[model samples]
Target: MQVKLIFSALTMATLLGACQKAPEPVVTTDAWSPLAQRYVSLVLALGEHDKSYVDAYYGPAEWAEQAKTAGQSAADIATAGSALQAEIRALSATDTMLRLRQHYLITQLTALISHAQTLATGKRASFEQQAQQLYDTLPPQRELASFDTILAELEALVPGEGDLTERVVAYRAGFVIPQDKQQQVFERAIAECQARTLSRIDLPQQERFTLEFVEDKPWSGYNWYQGAAYSLIQINIERPIDISRAVDLGCHEGYPGHHTYNALLEQKLKNELQWVEFSVYPLFSPQSLIAEGTANYGISMAFPGEQKMQFERDVLYPLAGLDAALAAEYAQFLKLMAQLSYAGNEIARLYLNGEIDAATAQSLRQRYLLQSEAEAKQGIRFVDTYGAYVINYNWGKDLVKNYIEQGGSEDERWQRFISLLSTPKLPSSIAWE
Candidate 1:
C-alpha cells in the first residue's frame, strides 16, 4: 500500500511539472533599441507622404534620408510597420520604462499605419472614429441640442444682448491687439510666462525659443521643435489678436507649454538616456493629446485664480491699448465661454460627417461657443483641416487639469504638472480618478 501511494505521488508530481509553462518570448531583447530606432526612421520616411505627418524630427539626418529611401512607398512603410509591431509583440520587457516606451511606439505605429492605409485607399474615416484610432482617445458624444443648456448658462452670465454670441463678440472687439502692438505685447507676455514657469520647474540652462508671427496657417500656433534645447514658435496673425491670447499663447507656445515639454523630453530622454525614439514627433499620434492638453492647461496652471485676470488687467490690457476697466467683464466672458469648449467636437462631427454644412457648423460654433464671425471662420477652418483634433483643446485640457489638481496645494499641482511634462505619458495615464 505504501509503494502504491508513493507511485501515485510521483505520477502527480510528473503531471504538475509537465503543466508548468515555458517562458514566453519578449520584444525587449538586445535588438529592441535598434528596432525602436528603425521604427522612428521609418516614421520619418512615412512623414514625407503627408506634409503634416512629422511634426518634428531632430534625430540623425542620415536616418531621415534612410526613411525616405528604405520605406519609399506608403504600402511598403505600412508593411514594415506591421512587421515591426508583430516583432515587438513577440517579446517582453521587465523594465517599466522599456515597457511604456515600447507601448508608446506601438501605439504611434498603429496610427501611422492606419494613416498610410487611408492615404493609399483614399477612404476617410468618421471624425470620432479617426480620433479614437489615431489620437488614442474618444471625444465625448454630444448633440447640438445638448449645448442649449450651456448657452443658457452663458446667457445668465451676460444679459441684455441681441444674441449672446454677438454680444460677446462686440464686448471683446475693443480688446483686440493692434497690428503694431502684436510683437511687443507678445514678447512681454512670453517673458512673464517664462519667468513663472522657470520659478516652478527645473530645465536646462540653454533652453530657449524664437517667436515669430506668421499668417495663413491652418492652425493658430505651432512650435517647430529643433531639438537640443531650442524651438521656433509661430503665432498665426490671420485675424484680429485678442488681448487674452497673449497669456494663452505665451504659456502655450513658450514656457511650461510645447517648448518646455519638448525641451525636457529632449534633455532627459534623448540627451541623458540616449533614447532615439523621443527625437521624432508625429502630429497625429497620442502625443498630441498630451501636448495640446498640457499646453491649454498650462495657461491656468501658470496664471492660476484671479492672477491671470489681474496680470492682464495690470499689464496686457494697457499694452494692447485697451480700457482696463472692462477687463473684468472680458474676464467673466472668458470664464463662461470656456465651459462650452466641448461643443467644438460635436460641431466638428456634424460638419465633417455631412450632418451639417460648413455654414451651419460655423453658425453653431458662433451661437453656442460665442465667437465673432471671423473667429467662427477660423474655428471652422481648424475643423476642416484637423477633424477630431478639436478635442485636444478642451477635452485634453480638462483631463490634464483634473490630473494635476488632484492634490490640494498649488505647489503640489505644479509638481504633478512638471512630472507629466517630463515623462512619456499617454491618455490613460491622466484618466480622472
Candidate 2:
C-alpha cells in the first residue's frame, strides 16, 4: 500500500503558543473594564482545567468569579463566545494580517463547538469515544499527540492549579518575569530603546517605564501593556536577536514602538469611559489592532522620512558582524523562511480543512521549508491539525507597515500615533483619514 505522507516542517511552527492575558488587579478597581472582564471570563472558562495558567494570567478573584459563571447561564457562554468572535472578526477583517487570524479564530470556535456539543449530549463516555475516534484518524505523524500533553507543559509554567482564589494570587505573584536579571535587561533595553526614541512621543523616563526581566521564562519577545502600570513589558533574553532583528524588533517591541505608545496612552488618556478599554488590553478585541499594528510598524514609523536602506547598510548590518554581501544573504534567508512559513501554513490549513491529501501536505512542507524527510512527515500532521497561524509573524508585519504608510505623517507624529492607539475599542479598520 502506497501511504501518503504530509511533510512536517510546517507543523513545528504550530506548536509555538502565542499571546497571554494580563494579570488582573487585586482591588475592585472600578468594576474593571468591561473588555478586560470579558477576556478574563473567557480564559477562565477555556482554561479552567488548568488553574495555574488561568490564575497566573487572570488572577485569583476574577478567575474564581469567571469559573462560577462558566457553568452558569448558557446565555453567558454564548455571549462570551459571540463577543470574542465578533471582536476577532472585526479586527481581522480590517487588515490582511488580521484576516489570516480569522482562520485561527474559526478553528478555536470549531473546537469549542465540538466540546460543547459533546457536553450537551450528556454522554460522557460517548464524547470521549468520539474524541478518541478523531484522534485515531489523525495522520501517523500526529498520532499520540494529545491536548493533555500541551496543557501539561503550560501548567508547569503557570502557578495555582486549583482553587480560583489561590490561582489568582499565584497569577499576580507569577505574572512578572523574574526580578534578578530584570534590571540588567531593562537597563540594556532602555539604553537600546533611547536610540530609537527620538521619533517617539515625548515622555519622561520614569513615565516611559521599564519592566525588569527576572528568571528565565518561556515568553515571546518582550511585550507592552498600557495599564495602571506604565508600559508593562516582558522580555526573554534567551531569544537573542542579532542587530538587524534588534533594531526592527526593538523599535517594534520597545520605545517608539509598543512600549512607548502604550505608556504615552496610559498617561495621556484618562477619560474614564474613553481610553479605559485600551488600558486593559483584550487579545481578540479591536484594541488588538492598535496594539499589534504600531508595534509591527515601530521600525518604519521611527525611520519614516529617512532611508531604510541606509539604516540597514550603516547601522544594523555592521552591528550583526556581517559584511554587505553576507548581510544581504542572511536577509534573503530570513525572507525565504518567512515565505516558506506562509506557504506551509496555506498547505496545512487546506489539508486540515479537508481540501488536500496527506502526501500533498508533506510535499508542501518539504519543498518549501527544506525539512528533513522525517521532520517533514511529522510537520504535515501538525499543520493539518493546527491550520494557518504561522502567517501572523511576517504577514502581520506587512499589514501594519501598509496601514502606517497609508496614514500621513505630521510633526512628532508618534504623539498622534499614541492618541490613536488609546482610542476606546477602536477597530482595526480604523484609519486616520
Candidate 3:
C-alpha cells in the first residue's frame, strides 16, 4: 500500500499566502548588484583555500583567474567576507524580490565566513552546530530505538534470515542492474524524467547535460553545473547499482533535479534578473540545502505514487533484463528502507560528536541502513569527508516535500516546485511547520 504525505491545511495556507503577497515598491536604488558581484568574487577567493568550496562556477573567466592570482588566505577571505557582509547589511530593500536577494546574500556570506574561519583555525564545530551554521538548518535528532518499529516491519516483509540486514541485502542482490544494461536503463529513465519535466516547466532549449559513470567517489552521484545551462553528471559505479536507482539517479542528478534546477536558476535568476551570485554555487551554504532537498524531492514529483514502480516494471525491467514481477515488492522494500534514511544523519552526529567510534557507526549503518560492508565503508568515508552534509539528502528532501506538497493538485505542486527551483529561496525561507 502506498501512503501519500501531506502537510496540514494551516501550514499550506500560510505558505500559499506568503507566495501570493505582492512585493513592496522599490524605495532604494539597486545597491545589491555590486554586493552580488563581490559575493561571487569572495566565493571564488575562498575556493582557492578550499578546493571543494566552489562546487560550480559559470561566471567570468577573469574573475576566477584573479581570485587564483590574488591567493587570499582563509583568514584574509574571512575578513573580506565580513566586510562584504557589513556592506550588504547597510543596504535596504523594500521590494520582496530584493529582500529575498538580500536575505540570500546575508545567509550565504555567513556560511562563507564560518567555513573560512574553520579552514583558517582548523577547528570544526559539532555536527549539529556545523549543520546549523553552514547549511542554515538543523537536522532533527532521532534515536536509534525510534527506528525499531520500522525494522520490525521490514522483518515481517523479509523473514527467514541469519541476520535481517543479510536477508534484505540478499533479496536486493537479485535486482542489481548488470554492467552492460546500466547505460540503456539509465538513459531511458532520464529521458522519461526529462519529458515529464518539460511538460510542466519551461526551460531553455539549450539546456542539456552529459552523463558518465565513474568510480572512486564518496557520494553516489554528482552534477557539475557548467555555465550556459549545461551539467556534467557522473554516477559512481564502484558498488552494485540496484534497478530502482535508474529513476532515482535520473530524476536526482539529471532532469528536473540538479540539471533542471541549475538551468532555471541560470536562465531566470542569473541571465534574466542579472543576479551574479547565482552564477557561482558554494557547496557548503544554505543554497545547498535547497539544491539538494529539491533534487531529492524531484524523484517523487516526476513519478508520484505507484507510477515509478510501474515505469520500472514495464520499461526499465525489460531494458535491464530484470524480473518485472519483483518490482512492486522491491519498491515497497525500498520505501521501508527510506524510513531509515535518517539513520545516516544520526550515525554521523554520534560519530562526529565522539559519542561513537567509526566502527560503531559502520555497524549501526549496516544494521539500520542495511548497507553492505563496502557500502557502509563508503558511507563512513562520506561522513569523514563531508561531515554533516549527510543530513541534506534526507532532511532536505523532507523539507522540500513538506513545502511543495502543503496542499495542492499535482499540477499545482509542480508550479510551486518550479517556483522554488527558479528562485533565491533558502532553507531558512522554507516554512517547515
Best by lDDT: 3
What lDDT would each prediction earn against the true structure? 0.79, 0.43, 0.85
Q: In model 3, which range of ten residues has the least summed lDDT?
A: 1-10
**Rank order (by TM-score, best first):** 3, 1, 2
What's the distance in Å from true for residue 136, model 1?
Answer: 0.9
Q: Tens-digit lDDT track for model 2 on 1-433?
A: 1112111121233222112223334333542334344544554564443222221232445455657665743334445666565655554246542343353343333334333343345333221232222111111122212223433433453345654323423433322324333333234434554566643456533443444332234333455454432444554444333334445545666667666656555544432333222333323223334455566666566555444445655654444344544444444433434434445545554565566788877765555444545556656644432233233344444554554455465443554555555443233333433
Candidates 2 and 3 compared: the better one by lDDT is: 3
Give the range where candidate 2 is weakest over 10 consecutive residues by summed lDDT.
1-10
In candidate 1, what are the lDDT values of residues 1-433, reduced to their tens digit?
Answer: 0011001112344344433332221224476777778788777877888878898888777778877776478888888889988888777867766766677778888888888787777777788777877888886787668778877877787756677877777766678999888887888888899889989887776566667778877777788887766677888887778899988998998878999999888777776767777888888888888899999999988888899899999998888888989888889878777778778788888887888999998898888878888888988988776777888888888878888889789888887888778777778655422
- Residue 303, candidate 2: alpha-carbon lDDT: 59
* Separate clash counts for every candidate: 4, 17, 0
Off by over 4 Å in 2: 1-76, 79-190, 203-226, 230-242, 264-276, 284-286, 305-341, 351-366, 369-395, 409-416, 425-428
